[model samples]
Target: MAKQYTKNLIKREFLKLLEEENFNNITIAMLAERCEISRNTFYYHYEDIYMLVREILRDELEKVDEEFNETFSWEESLLHAVSFLLKNKKAAQNLFRSIDKKEIDSYLYKICESVMSRYVDNECQSKTIDAKEYDKRLVTDFYRAALVGLLDKWIQDGMKESPDKVIFRIGKLFDGNIERSLRISENLDEA
Candidate 1:
């Protein structure tokens, strides 16, 4: 309870500073000052700034996972996930441009892979596809790569496009073709 509150406060301050300066430029003292907490309190909650960033990324992924679980459609799930980025554009941008970008990319890959896996599982359950686990994983990897690629571009381009517009374009590209594409790949592999 209190611990969670402290962590959240620290995360909030960290993100606030990320907007004004690069993650590398942010220090424990800066965070403590912004949050009005002692430097020891900041260290009490997080081992270091990297730990805070990782926790925030993991927390955001868990949030989207929960939302995805409640969703009836993949589109809804994806939009829910993207809403986090939309809401935290400044923080997101700073993280992307930070020296810790590799960490951010790894986290983003995990979230994308999870989302793709969920989408594949839901589709399989609906009898939309009868794919083997391997095929499903292959498809998941493909979509995850594409999704992450698009996200990298979006972040690099300053996220100028709206999430809805980007999502709609993605849906148009693959909304109903995942199963068909997997089948096509299987057929090509058998040849």
Candidate 2:
């Protein structure tokens, strides 16, 4: 439990540092100093700064699991997730704009893919979506690509609009019937 407590402290301080500094310039030594712990102590919990980021991101992403259930509207679930992401806007921006854009992009894509996969599988059971097992995977990947592209653009655009707005407009790609219907046209959030 002591290690868990320390890990939480480390995650919080890491996010604070991310909000204040760019990823390129922030170092583990700086983070440890900010947390009032030795560099060795920081390393004991995290391999490096990016490891801390991954842990923090996992925690953030996990918060919306309850929102993923059958009770909430898909848009509401999406809004809740995006709103949580936007809560630490600066931290998210710094992380996204880092040198390892690929890893971060992949993480975001995975999250979207998971959400879309569940949605498709659940809906297709009742014939709402026309997809076989193999095709479902492909379509989910394609949709994930769209979401990732849009999110990347939002990051590049300095998040000019709130993530909820972005999600809403993206949902519109399915013509606002995304809740009950699944159709693939085009989502221009990347454009």
Give the root-mean-square deviation of each candidate in angstroms. Answer: 2.5, 5.7
The TM-score of predicted model 2 comes to 0.80
* Candidate 1: residue pairs that collide: none
lDDT by residue (142-173, candidate 1, tens digit) is: 88888888777888899888766776777877
Can you list the residue pairs that collide in candidate 2?
none
Candidate 2 lDDT over residue span 54-73, tens digit each: 77777766765545764444
Question: How displaced is residue 15 in candidate 1, in Å?
Answer: 1.5
Residue 74 of model 2 has an lDDT of 46
Q: For candidate 1, give the lDDT of residue 47.
A: 89
What is candidate 1's TM-score against the reference? 0.88
Give me the candidate number with maximum TM-score: 1
